[model samples]
Target: GAGVSQSPRYKVAKRGQDVALRCDPISGHVSLFWYQQALGQGPEFLTYFQNEAQLDKSGLPSDRFFAERPEGSVSTLKIQRTQQEDSAVYLCASSPRTGRKGYGYTFGSGTRLTVV
Candidate 1:
Protein backbone atom coordinates (compact mmCIF):
# COMPACT_ATOMS: atom_id res chain seq x y z
CA GLY A 1 0.00 0.00 0.00
CA ALA A 2 3.02 2.24 -0.14
CA GLY A 3 2.89 5.25 -2.41
CA VAL A 4 5.41 6.08 -5.08
CA SER A 5 8.70 7.51 -3.81
CA GLN A 6 11.77 9.09 -5.37
CA SER A 7 15.25 9.58 -3.92
CA PRO A 8 17.39 12.65 -3.33
CA ARG A 9 14.45 15.01 -3.74
CA TYR A 10 17.14 17.46 -4.78
CA LYS A 11 20.39 16.93 -6.60
CA VAL A 12 23.19 19.21 -7.71
CA ALA A 13 25.43 18.12 -10.52
CA LYS A 14 28.35 19.54 -12.41
CA ARG A 15 28.21 19.73 -16.14
CA GLY A 16 29.40 16.64 -18.00
CA GLN A 17 28.85 14.43 -14.96
CA ASP A 18 26.45 11.55 -14.62
CA VAL A 19 23.61 11.16 -12.16
CA ALA A 20 21.26 8.38 -11.26
CA LEU A 21 17.88 8.82 -9.63
CA ARG A 22 15.75 6.04 -8.17
CA CYS A 23 12.05 5.40 -7.87
CA ASP A 24 9.93 2.91 -5.95
CA PRO A 25 6.43 2.36 -7.16
CA ILE A 26 3.41 1.37 -5.15
CA SER A 27 2.99 -2.30 -4.46
CA GLY A 28 0.88 -4.29 -6.92
CA HIS A 29 0.85 -1.45 -9.41
CA VAL A 30 1.27 -2.63 -12.97
CA SER A 31 2.48 0.52 -14.62
CA LEU A 32 5.27 2.98 -13.91
CA PHE A 33 6.21 6.22 -15.64
CA TRP A 34 8.94 8.84 -15.52
CA TYR A 35 8.44 12.44 -16.41
CA GLN A 36 10.49 15.59 -16.63
CA GLN A 37 9.22 19.02 -15.68
CA ALA A 38 11.06 22.14 -16.54
CA LEU A 39 10.47 25.36 -14.68
CA GLY A 40 7.04 26.78 -15.42
CA GLN A 41 6.23 23.84 -17.67
CA GLY A 42 4.06 20.79 -17.34
CA PRO A 43 5.48 17.40 -16.79
CA GLU A 44 6.47 15.55 -19.94
CA PHE A 45 6.56 11.79 -20.18
CA LEU A 46 10.07 10.46 -20.38
CA THR A 47 9.56 6.72 -20.30
CA TYR A 48 7.15 4.08 -19.15
CA PHE A 49 7.16 0.46 -18.14
CA GLN A 50 4.54 -2.14 -17.48
CA ASN A 51 5.55 -5.08 -15.37
CA GLU A 52 9.21 -4.81 -16.25
CA ALA A 53 8.61 -4.23 -19.93
CA GLN A 54 9.42 -0.74 -21.13
CA LEU A 55 6.45 0.21 -23.31
CA ASP A 56 7.44 3.75 -24.30
CA LYS A 57 10.55 5.86 -24.23
CA SER A 58 10.17 8.22 -27.14
CA GLY A 59 9.83 11.13 -24.79
CA LEU A 60 13.36 10.85 -23.57
CA PRO A 61 14.99 14.05 -24.69
CA SER A 62 18.31 12.66 -25.72
CA ASP A 63 20.49 9.58 -25.93
CA ARG A 64 22.10 10.70 -22.68
CA PHE A 65 18.99 9.76 -20.79
CA PHE A 66 18.34 6.12 -19.97
CA ALA A 67 15.94 4.25 -17.72
CA GLU A 68 15.24 0.75 -16.54
CA ARG A 69 12.80 -1.21 -14.46
CA PRO A 70 14.52 -4.54 -14.04
CA GLU A 71 12.14 -5.83 -11.38
CA GLY A 72 8.92 -4.14 -12.53
CA SER A 73 8.30 -2.49 -9.19
CA VAL A 74 11.33 -0.26 -8.93
CA SER A 75 12.84 1.90 -11.64
CA THR A 76 15.79 4.16 -12.23
CA LEU A 77 16.66 6.98 -14.58
CA LYS A 78 20.25 7.70 -15.37
CA ILE A 79 21.60 10.71 -17.16
CA GLN A 80 25.05 10.94 -18.63
CA ARG A 81 26.93 14.07 -19.59
CA THR A 82 24.66 16.20 -17.52
CA GLN A 83 23.96 19.60 -19.01
CA GLN A 84 22.35 22.72 -17.63
CA GLU A 85 19.42 22.09 -19.89
CA ASP A 86 18.94 18.79 -18.11
CA SER A 87 18.06 20.65 -14.95
CA ALA A 88 14.53 19.80 -14.09
CA VAL A 89 12.32 17.84 -11.74
CA TYR A 90 12.26 14.13 -12.43
CA LEU A 91 8.95 12.72 -11.34
CA CYS A 92 7.87 9.10 -10.97
CA ALA A 93 4.36 7.82 -10.99
CA SER A 94 2.45 4.56 -10.94
CA SER A 95 -1.02 3.35 -11.65
CA PRO A 96 -2.97 0.21 -10.93
CA ARG A 97 -2.91 -0.50 -14.63
CA THR A 98 -2.32 1.21 -17.91
CA GLY A 99 -5.21 2.50 -20.04
CA ARG A 100 -7.78 2.08 -17.31
CA LYS A 101 -9.86 5.16 -16.87
CA GLY A 102 -10.28 6.42 -13.30
CA TYR A 103 -7.18 4.56 -12.22
CA GLY A 104 -5.12 7.70 -12.13
CA TYR A 105 -1.43 7.78 -11.40
CA THR A 106 0.12 8.75 -8.08
CA PHE A 107 3.24 10.84 -8.30
CA GLY A 108 6.26 11.27 -6.10
CA SER A 109 7.44 14.69 -4.98
CA GLY A 110 10.18 14.39 -7.60
CA THR A 111 13.92 14.81 -7.80
CA ARG A 112 14.99 18.32 -8.67
CA LEU A 113 18.26 18.24 -10.55
CA THR A 114 20.31 21.38 -10.87
CA VAL A 115 23.25 21.47 -13.22
CA VAL A 116 25.96 24.05 -12.57
Candidate 2:
Protein backbone atom coordinates (compact mmCIF):
# COMPACT_ATOMS: atom_id res chain seq x y z
CA GLY A 1 0.00 0.00 0.00
CA ALA A 2 1.05 3.63 -0.48
CA GLY A 3 0.50 4.43 3.16
CA VAL A 4 -0.02 2.51 6.38
CA SER A 5 -3.27 0.62 6.25
CA GLN A 6 -5.17 -0.80 9.19
CA SER A 7 -8.10 -3.17 9.14
CA PRO A 8 -11.43 -2.99 10.93
CA ARG A 9 -11.28 0.75 11.48
CA TYR A 10 -13.70 0.32 14.34
CA LYS A 11 -14.11 -2.67 16.60
CA VAL A 12 -16.48 -3.41 19.44
CA ALA A 13 -15.60 -6.27 21.72
CA LYS A 14 -17.28 -7.73 24.75
CA ARG A 15 -15.41 -7.31 28.00
CA GLY A 16 -13.89 -10.74 27.84
CA GLN A 17 -13.50 -11.16 24.10
CA ASP A 18 -10.19 -11.21 22.34
CA VAL A 19 -9.44 -9.02 19.33
CA ALA A 20 -6.75 -8.84 16.70
CA LEU A 21 -5.93 -5.63 14.91
CA ARG A 22 -4.00 -5.68 11.68
CA CYS A 23 -1.58 -3.22 10.17
CA ASP A 24 0.01 -3.21 6.73
CA PRO A 25 2.81 -0.71 6.58
CA ILE A 26 4.47 0.88 3.62
CA SER A 27 6.76 -1.42 1.74
CA GLY A 28 10.41 -1.39 2.87
CA HIS A 29 9.70 0.36 6.15
CA VAL A 30 12.19 -1.08 8.63
CA SER A 31 10.56 -0.08 11.85
CA LEU A 32 7.03 -0.69 13.09
CA PHE A 33 5.42 0.49 16.29
CA TRP A 34 2.12 -0.14 18.02
CA TYR A 35 0.57 2.47 20.24
CA GLN A 36 -2.52 2.73 22.42
CA GLN A 37 -4.51 5.90 22.81
CA ALA A 38 -7.08 6.35 25.51
CA LEU A 39 -9.97 8.73 25.11
CA GLY A 40 -8.67 12.31 25.06
CA GLN A 41 -5.13 11.16 25.67
CA GLY A 42 -2.07 11.05 23.47
CA PRO A 43 -0.88 7.80 21.98
CA GLU A 44 1.32 5.73 24.25
CA PHE A 45 3.91 3.36 22.88
CA LEU A 46 2.95 -0.29 23.15
CA THR A 47 5.70 -2.09 21.27
CA TYR A 48 8.34 -1.70 18.60
CA PHE A 49 9.75 -4.04 16.00
CA GLN A 50 12.79 -3.64 13.85
CA ASN A 51 12.39 -5.87 10.86
CA GLU A 52 11.18 -9.28 12.11
CA ALA A 53 12.75 -8.86 15.51
CA GLN A 54 10.88 -7.38 18.44
CA LEU A 55 13.36 -4.86 19.78
CA ASP A 56 11.16 -3.50 22.52
CA LYS A 57 7.89 -4.43 24.16
CA SER A 58 8.22 -2.56 27.40
CA GLY A 59 5.19 -0.43 26.75
CA LEU A 60 2.70 -3.24 26.46
CA PRO A 61 0.21 -2.79 29.25
CA SER A 62 0.14 -6.40 30.35
CA ASP A 63 0.62 -9.99 29.30
CA ARG A 64 -2.75 -9.84 27.61
CA PHE A 65 -1.28 -7.59 24.93
CA PHE A 66 0.93 -9.02 22.23
CA ALA A 67 2.29 -7.65 18.97
CA GLU A 68 4.23 -9.26 16.17
CA ARG A 69 5.68 -8.58 12.75
CA PRO A 70 6.95 -11.97 11.64
CA GLU A 71 7.82 -11.03 8.07
CA GLY A 72 8.49 -7.41 8.98
CA SER A 73 5.81 -6.17 6.62
CA VAL A 74 2.39 -6.94 7.99
CA SER A 75 1.83 -6.82 11.73
CA THR A 76 -0.85 -7.67 14.23
CA LEU A 77 -1.69 -6.50 17.74
CA LYS A 78 -3.70 -8.99 19.72
CA ILE A 79 -5.41 -8.48 23.01
CA GLN A 80 -6.71 -11.36 25.07
CA ARG A 81 -9.44 -11.28 27.67
CA THR A 82 -10.19 -7.71 26.85
CA GLN A 83 -11.29 -5.47 29.66
CA GLN A 84 -13.35 -2.29 29.76
CA GLU A 85 -10.16 -0.38 30.47
CA ASP A 86 -8.76 -1.73 27.23
CA SER A 87 -11.13 0.31 25.15
CA ALA A 88 -9.02 2.70 23.12
CA VAL A 89 -7.65 3.51 19.69
CA TYR A 90 -4.88 1.23 18.55
CA LEU A 91 -2.45 2.86 16.13
CA CYS A 92 0.21 1.40 13.87
CA ALA A 93 3.15 3.41 12.63
CA SER A 94 6.11 2.67 10.44
CA SER A 95 9.37 4.37 9.67
CA PRO A 96 12.34 3.66 7.50
CA ARG A 97 14.73 4.22 10.35
CA THR A 98 15.68 1.63 12.91
CA GLY A 99 14.52 3.73 15.80
CA ARG A 100 11.88 6.45 16.00
CA LYS A 101 14.21 9.00 17.54
CA GLY A 102 15.09 11.01 14.45
CA TYR A 103 12.55 10.00 11.86
CA GLY A 104 8.90 10.65 11.38
CA TYR A 105 6.50 7.74 11.18
CA THR A 106 3.64 7.11 8.83
CA PHE A 107 0.61 6.26 10.93
CA GLY A 108 -2.48 4.28 10.10
CA SER A 109 -5.96 5.36 10.85
CA GLY A 110 -6.30 3.69 14.21
CA THR A 111 -8.66 0.85 15.02
CA ARG A 112 -10.94 2.01 17.74
CA LEU A 113 -11.82 -0.79 20.15
CA THR A 114 -14.82 -0.38 22.33
CA VAL A 115 -15.28 -2.84 25.15
CA VAL A 116 -18.65 -3.18 26.78
Candidate 3:
Protein backbone atom coordinates (compact mmCIF):
# COMPACT_ATOMS: atom_id res chain seq x y z
CA GLY A 1 0.00 0.00 0.00
CA ALA A 2 1.14 3.55 -0.66
CA GLY A 3 0.27 4.61 2.86
CA VAL A 4 -0.71 3.10 6.16
CA SER A 5 -3.76 0.87 5.98
CA GLN A 6 -5.94 -0.10 8.92
CA SER A 7 -8.58 -2.81 8.95
CA PRO A 8 -12.19 -2.47 10.06
CA ARG A 9 -12.50 1.28 10.02
CA TYR A 10 -15.31 0.83 12.50
CA LYS A 11 -15.79 -1.92 15.08
CA VAL A 12 -18.58 -2.60 17.48
CA ALA A 13 -17.81 -4.88 20.40
CA LYS A 14 -19.89 -6.14 23.26
CA ARG A 15 -18.70 -5.62 26.77
CA GLY A 16 -15.97 -8.11 27.72
CA GLN A 17 -15.34 -9.02 24.11
CA ASP A 18 -11.86 -9.07 22.71
CA VAL A 19 -10.89 -7.27 19.53
CA ALA A 20 -7.82 -7.02 17.37
CA LEU A 21 -7.00 -4.00 15.22
CA ARG A 22 -4.59 -4.42 12.34
CA CYS A 23 -2.26 -1.91 10.76
CA ASP A 24 -0.24 -2.22 7.58
CA PRO A 25 2.34 0.52 7.38
CA ILE A 26 4.03 1.83 4.33
CA SER A 27 6.74 -0.43 2.99
CA GLY A 28 10.14 0.03 4.64
CA HIS A 29 8.93 2.19 7.51
CA VAL A 30 11.08 1.40 10.53
CA SER A 31 9.07 2.97 13.28
CA LEU A 32 5.51 1.95 14.09
CA PHE A 33 3.31 3.45 16.80
CA TRP A 34 -0.08 2.71 18.32
CA TYR A 35 -2.21 5.37 19.94
CA GLN A 36 -5.57 5.69 21.59
CA GLN A 37 -7.81 8.66 20.93
CA ALA A 38 -10.76 9.55 23.06
CA LEU A 39 -13.58 11.48 21.51
CA GLY A 40 -12.71 15.15 21.00
CA GLN A 41 -9.15 14.68 22.16
CA GLY A 42 -5.78 14.10 20.54
CA PRO A 43 -4.27 10.69 20.19
CA GLU A 44 -2.36 9.36 23.13
CA PHE A 45 0.69 7.20 22.59
CA LEU A 46 0.08 3.57 23.44
CA THR A 47 3.13 1.70 22.21
CA TYR A 48 6.05 1.91 19.85
CA PHE A 49 7.91 -0.71 17.83
CA GLN A 50 11.15 -0.38 16.01
CA ASN A 51 11.66 -3.05 13.41
CA GLU A 52 9.78 -5.86 15.14
CA ALA A 53 11.28 -5.08 18.52
CA GLN A 54 8.95 -3.50 21.01
CA LEU A 55 11.17 -0.68 22.14
CA ASP A 56 8.52 1.10 24.20
CA LYS A 57 5.26 -0.12 25.64
CA SER A 58 5.19 2.04 28.74
CA GLY A 59 2.26 4.02 27.43
CA LEU A 60 -0.04 1.00 27.34
CA PRO A 61 -2.93 1.65 29.72
CA SER A 62 -3.07 -1.88 31.08
CA ASP A 63 -2.08 -5.48 30.55
CA ARG A 64 -5.21 -6.03 28.51
CA PHE A 65 -3.86 -3.79 25.80
CA PHE A 66 -1.18 -5.42 23.66
CA ALA A 67 0.49 -4.35 20.47
CA GLU A 68 3.04 -6.04 18.28
CA ARG A 69 4.81 -5.74 14.99
CA PRO A 70 6.28 -9.15 14.31
CA GLU A 71 7.92 -8.34 10.97
CA GLY A 72 8.26 -4.59 11.54
CA SER A 73 5.75 -3.97 8.77
CA VAL A 74 2.30 -5.02 9.88
CA SER A 75 1.20 -4.32 13.45
CA THR A 76 -1.71 -5.42 15.56
CA LEU A 77 -3.33 -3.92 18.64
CA LYS A 78 -5.29 -6.40 20.69
CA ILE A 79 -7.67 -5.42 23.40
CA GLN A 80 -8.73 -8.08 25.83
CA ARG A 81 -11.93 -7.60 27.82
CA THR A 82 -13.39 -4.63 26.10
CA GLN A 83 -15.04 -2.09 28.34
CA GLN A 84 -17.13 1.03 27.84
CA GLU A 85 -14.07 3.10 28.63
CA ASP A 86 -12.24 1.43 25.79
CA SER A 87 -14.55 2.97 23.25
CA ALA A 88 -12.29 5.18 21.21
CA VAL A 89 -10.29 5.38 18.04
CA TYR A 90 -7.15 3.33 17.77
CA LEU A 91 -4.58 4.94 15.56
CA CYS A 92 -1.50 3.54 13.87
CA ALA A 93 1.43 5.61 12.66
CA SER A 94 4.66 4.86 10.86
CA SER A 95 7.83 6.79 10.39
CA PRO A 96 10.84 6.23 8.21
CA ARG A 97 13.35 7.17 10.91
CA THR A 98 13.84 5.41 14.19
CA GLY A 99 15.04 8.49 16.00
CA ARG A 100 11.55 9.98 15.67
CA LYS A 101 12.77 13.38 16.81
CA GLY A 102 10.97 16.09 14.92
CA TYR A 103 10.18 13.67 12.17
CA GLY A 104 6.86 13.50 10.38
CA TYR A 105 4.82 10.33 10.58
CA THR A 106 2.19 8.82 8.32
CA PHE A 107 -0.95 7.88 10.19
CA GLY A 108 -3.88 5.66 9.38
CA SER A 109 -7.49 6.77 9.53
CA GLY A 110 -7.83 4.74 12.69
CA THR A 111 -10.22 2.04 13.90
CA ARG A 112 -13.16 3.35 15.85
CA LEU A 113 -14.13 0.84 18.51
CA THR A 114 -17.47 1.16 20.22
CA VAL A 115 -18.11 -0.96 23.26
CA VAL A 116 -21.57 -1.61 24.54
lDDT of each: 0.94, 0.94, 0.93
- Predicted candidate 1 versus true structure: per-residue lDDT over 1-116, tens digit per residue: 47888998999999999999999999999999999999999999999999999999999999999999998888999999999999999999999874647688999999999999
For model 1, what is the alpha-carbon lDDT of residue 19?
99
Model 3 misplaced stretches (Cα beyond 4 Å): 98-102
lDDT accuracy of residue 82 in candidate 1: 100
Clashing pairs in 3: none
Cα deviation at 26, candidate 3, in Å, is 0.6
lDDT for 28 in candidate 2 is 95
Against the hidden true structure, what lDDT does model 1 obtain?
Answer: 0.94
Q: How well does candidate 3 match the true structure, expressed as C-alpha RMSD?
A: 1.4
Q: Itemize residue pairs with steric clashes in candidate 2.
A: none
Give one digit per residue, the lDDT tens place, for model 2 in 2-46: 999999899999999999999999999999999999999999999
* Tens-digit lDDT string for candidate 3 (20-112): 999999999899999999999999999999899999999999999999888778999999999999999999999989563767889999999
Q: Which residue pairs in model 1 clash with each other?
A: none
